[model samples]
Structures are given as structure tokens and as C-alpha cells.
Target: MELDSEIKDRSRESPSPEVGIDGRDRSASTTRPTLILYSHGRTPPLNPPPDLKYDLRSIPNPPKNARDAHDGRSKRLREHLLGELKFVQKLDEVESEILEAMEAKIVETAEKLENDQDRRDDGEESRENGEEEGYESLEDEYDPTEAVLRVGCNCALGHHRSVAFVEELARRKWPRNWSVQLIHRDIDRRRGNDKKVRGKSLRWGGA
Candidate 1:
């Protein structure tokens, strides 16, 4: 059999390829997906001849001295496999570092997604509650025949405060658009029971 070096040179010299790991030029097929696995730099018995078409190479985790998985995806898969093998195989510091970083990155991504989902849920809940509670709305509380101008006076409170509020409104030259009437609250019980006395307490002005 031609040596691995002689085969490599022949490949460069000619365009024809019979796919074998050592014989094939690494540069020509760097982007192919197949992961040809080896143990201690030798092929396994079940391995097929090198010329077969293969995709998605599954590389076994490399030793600590084995630095830099040549292809990007290959490196990731190697590190992931190393992490899985941690319990079975005792890993060195270098392998431990790579596994730890990978784990941290995964955890961080999960936390970020969870926090984003929680914020969206909270915002939706707050919006629904505001809609239910009628937030910042005065329409339902408004009354066309109601007046809020009030003052408390134990003596003739309904008339005293009621009249004063109307006078204050006039002093300010407020718009007189609504009707106003004073409904005395048990004024007859406090003052004389005579019809004239009760009639004096009940008065009307304008809003």
C-alpha cells in the first residue's frame, strides 16, 4: 500500500479522491459534516473504507492535551461529549474549564428567556386588570344633576354651606349652566316645625 504521505501528495497532484481520513486533504473537505472517530489515532474494526460518503461526524472527546477541534461544529460536539463523559472519565483542568463555560452559557441563556417571558406575562396581567378596574376614567362617576361644592356646618348646614357655595360660584363668575336645589336634611327637626320655618331652609340658586 502507498504510504499516507504518498497518498496525500497524489491527492494534491490529481483531482480524484478516494476518501480515507489520512489520505484525503483536510483543506478540501473541511466543511463536510461527517465526524470520523478514532481512538489513539487508529481506526476501529467496524470502520468502513475511507472512500464512503459520510455526513455529521461524531468525534469522541479529546484528551486534555488535544487542543483545538479543527472545525467549529466539531469542537462544540467534542466539548458537549466531554461534559457527558465527566462522570465516567476523570477530566483534567482544561476539560473541566471548557465544560464549565459551556454549562454557564446554557444556564445564562435559559435565565434570560425565562425573565423575558415573566415580564411579558406581568405586562399582560396589568393591562387586563386596568381594563377591569376602569383605570383613569371619570365618565361612570359623573352625574349630570350632581354638585360637589360642600361645607359642613352643624347649624343649618344644608342652607348655610349650600348658599355660601352658590355665592362663591357667582363671585368667581362661573358658568351658570346647570340647575341647583338645596334639599334640607331634617332641618324641620332642628328648627321650628312650622311650614314657614322649614320652607325658609329649603332654597334654590344655580350651578
Candidate 2:
């Protein structure tokens, strides 16, 4: 009994395992790690200190010869316009050829129609006079060729060129049996803006 009492007294005198720094009881520290932090909420100092001054220099200006720059720009603009004009002229020539071909086709079709009518009339007369057994109209034998006029424009300036070409072709009385199709390929792809003109097909029965 005396030995047990001595052990109990020693146990009471021992330092607690739950005590931490600054005399705070730390029962939670026994089960997990404890972190002791001291913060006064002070901002960090800037490197090199706030009293340091910076010396900045102005950027150099470009050459002040405005006439040279203007001349260069004007030359470029003239060359571009000339090249566009040449291209448009070529398109005009092609359009003229197409229009002429259309006119020839129209004349040929009209002549063929007239001849067919004459032949039909002759066949009818022959059938009535007992020279033939049946009268068949030549209209059934008509086989007209299909022609399509395709106009492609590649720039804003060329757009007007294409329109003029179409107008001239229309004025020339293109064949009723021919078709026309217009396409514009030059446009800013990023902006998604462009113009397209489609022509109606001209057939024998109706346009």
C-alpha cells in the first residue's frame, strides 16, 4: 500500500503531456501536429527600397520625309488600279465572245424552228393529197443544244465588271435556250460578307 501511494504521488507531480509553447494547454497536439504562428499583418518591403528613382528615355521618332512616303503609297495605288483595270478588260472581252456565241445560237434556233414549221406544213399537204400515209410535225424532232454562261468575279472592282458583262449579254438578246450562271469568289472569309448573283435559266418553253 505504501509503494502504491508513492507511485500515485509521483504521477501527480509529473508535467502534463498536453502542455504546449506559451503555457497553452495542448490536448489537441497529442492527437495531431500543432502549428504556432506569429503575425503582425505587416506588408513586405519592396526590393531595392521605395526611394529608388527610374530614368526613362523617350522613343526615337521616324524620318519626317512625308513626300517620299506619300509618293510610294500613290505609286502602289496606281499600279493596283491599273492591274485591276486590265483584268476587267479581259473579262469584258470574254463576255463579248460569250454574247456573240449566244446570238449565233439564237439565230440558229430560230432558223431551225422556221424550217421545221415549213416541213410540217409540207407533210400535212402530202398526207391530204395521198402522197404520204401520215403527217408528223417536225417540232417533235427539235433537239436544241444547252449553253450556259458562267461569270466569275474575284474582287470588288470585278463585281461591277461582272454586272456590266451580264447587262451587255442581256442587251444582245441571248438565246432563249441558253442558261446563265454568275459566281463571286473574292470576299473576306473572316467577315463572312459577300455578294452573289444567280441568273435564271432560259428554256424553249419558258424562262
Candidate 3:
């Protein structure tokens, strides 16, 4: 999608990155659109890849022993990382990029709807005469609930830094109309071992 430059070019409106979470109540139905946030390790998911990626390798990690006791989902570990000033700055940067991408998607969807309406208007006369060509409609490609952005946050082992960052990101205020999905791909897969760790479901509040 050439997301960075292309999104900026197509977006007619620029929203501030500091916008707070929308307090409006929203349903998790097909009528509501989505914004996916993915957290992973060194290797990122290829299918349905992210529009923006943030590397968290530089963020300070907690103690080595902490990996055994806690993954990034732990509040203790999250605070440990957030305690660093540099990490907070990085988070701010990520938020700005995500907002910009979302704005682009909104603009693109509006344009698509407008174009489809224009096509229908032009074909009105032909339809009345029963001479309109059988052609696919642009409306078929429109999905009101499709995902607007897939943002990836990665670190050395998806268990720690990336998990914390993505979890924290989700808690922040977002547009009420947009739903955020968090995926910690490698959280169960630990380092130096292929064995998987089974744990309770990770809870995402107000997702």
C-alpha cells in the first residue's frame, strides 16, 4: 500500500495524535469498523501484514528471571518499561503513525462511496431502457466493517516488550467508532524452547 507516503497524500484531513479516547458506547458488530494492533517477536506474521511496524528491541527489558514469572501482559512488567522516558516517547510516535493511517482509510472509503453513487446516477437512464451493460458494481467491494489498519509492534521475544507495548497501547483512548484487536503471536512460544505455555485468556478491556 506504500502506506506512509500514499496515506499522507490521499488523506484530506489530519487529526491530532493527542486525541483522547472516544467515550461513546459502540457495538462490536459488522456496522463498526476495526483497527488491528499486532504484537510479535523477531518474525512477524506475513498473512494480513501490518500497515505500520514498530521495533521495540531498543526498549529496556526487565530482569531475565522475570520472563519465567511474567510475560509482557503483566502490569509489573508494563510499568517497568513505561518507567523509561525513551520508551514513552517511542509510544507517542507509534500513536501518531496509527492515527494518520486511519485517517487515510476514512478518506479512501468516502471517495469509494461517492464514486459508486456517481456510477449509479450515470446508469439510471440506461437501466430504464433495459440496455445497461451487465457489469460488476463498485458497491460490492465496499465493507463498512473492514479493518482500517494493522499495526505491528515487535521486540526480541514477543513475550516481553512487544506484549507490554501493545497491551498498553490498547488501553489508550481511541476513536469510539473504531475497534482495536490485539494479537500477541509469540507470547505463548518462549525462547530456547519449542514448548508452548498454556495460560488463561488474556483480557482486553473495552476492546
Candidate 4:
């Protein structure tokens, strides 16, 4: 079936690509996976860590220019950071892993569901013969299509490299239909609290 039109929130001033469907019609009878992309810093751990986490601290920080560093969402900063060969290579590697992980998870879920169904079928026969208790129903079981692909990228500050990488990843075309939730967990962290560590990240400027 053809994909449904992008859903929009009426309260927003303009249509934002930040939230939208990636492929198939979610409203259709069949379910699809939802990929959550998170960008964060090292100080705090995510409540539930992503299934796959990529570290961007190895990638050198972008030039500290006021215009670009002042805003974490600046296109110029993204361009500068993305221009690095390391960044491109890392993105390609991460994308491939994401696809592999999602496909593996889907297959794993399908197998689990199949096994559950088989058990339930056997249990039903036993119950009919007054030999067994009630079995777990499909309603209480996992949905195969609900396989999740949670990916996180983190750097020193979570302002530039990690945030930009997640944003770029969120924008890419994926093989499967997905509902995406993009998050920058520590982008707005206060600079005052950040103690300057020698030879670590550049001076905390703006996120």
C-alpha cells in the first residue's frame, strides 16, 4: 500500500521535517518499526540506553567560530563538521550497522512470536483435554513489527559533532518504513557547570 501523507501538528507555525513518516503507511493494518535517534553528552547516562551507541569523541571538534559555535543547529557548523572524511566514513559505517541491527531484531521478534504461537496452540489443545491452565494470548504478546532501532551518538559536549551526526542520520533514507524521534539530550546543558579539562574538548562556548 502507498504511504500515507505526512501528519502535521496544527500548533506549529510551519511544517517541520523534524517529525515525519519515513516509508510505509503507519495507518495501514501492518505495523512498522520506530527508530529513535539520540545525541547526548558523557556526563549523564540515558535512562534507557540505545540498542546501538556510536562515539563521536574521536572525531576532532570543528573550528571554534562564534557564528557556528553559537548555535548548535547552525547549518554552517553541520557542513563544516560533515566535510570531514572521518565523519563521512563514520556515518556510512553507522548506517550499515543500523540496517543490519534492525533487520536482525525484526527476525528475532518474528521467531519469538512464532514460538509463542506454537506454545499457545499446544496449550489450547491441553486446555480442551482439561490438562493445562490458560495460555498467554496474542494481545499480551509482542508485536513482530514493533521492533525498535534505538541509536545514540555522543561526544564531549553533545553540541556539535554528535548532534550534527544524529540530525544527518535522521534525514537519511532507510530501507524500512519508520517513525522517527530525534532527540538532543544535552545540547542545552549550561556551560557554567562544565569544568575545563586539559586536552579534552575545546572550551565550552555555545550549544
lDDT of 1 by residue, 1-207 (tens): 122222223322212331333343322321211112111111111123322111112223334344232211133433444354432242233224333432333344334445645666776788888744323433366432232222111213222222222222222211122122232232223233433222222222231
TM-score, ranked from best to worst = 3, 4, 2, 1
User: Candidate 4 on 1-207: residue-level lDDT in tens?
Assistant: 011122222111212222222332223223355677888887676668789998899987887773344544566777877788999899999988987787566555555656766887888889899896565465645555576778888888777788888867755665424566677877767566665321112111010
Residues 1-207, model 3: lDDT tens digits: 232233334333213332323432222122334677777778635357778888899988888887678888888888888898878898888888787777665555545555666777777867888876566665566664454677888898688888888877776666555655677877787667766543233332122
For each candidate, C-alpha RMSD in Å?
A: 43.7, 44.5, 9.6, 10.3
Q: Tens-digit lDDT track for model 2 on 20-40?
A: 333455333212111111110
lDDT, model 1: 0.29
Residue 35 CA displacement from its true place in model 4, Å: 1.6
Clashes of 2: 0
What's model 4's overall lDDT? 0.64
Q: In angstroms, how far off is 41's CA in candidate 4?
A: 0.1
Best first by lDDT, ranked: 3, 4, 2, 1
Per-candidate TM-score against the hidden true structure: 0.20, 0.32, 0.72, 0.70
| Candidates 3 and 4, the one with greater lDDT | 3
lDDT of each: 0.29, 0.32, 0.66, 0.64
Error at 96, model 2, angstroms: 1.4
Alpha carbon lDDT of residue 187, candidate 4? 71
Off by over 4 Å in 2: 1-83, 133-179, 182-207
* 3 against 4, candidate with superior TM-score: 3
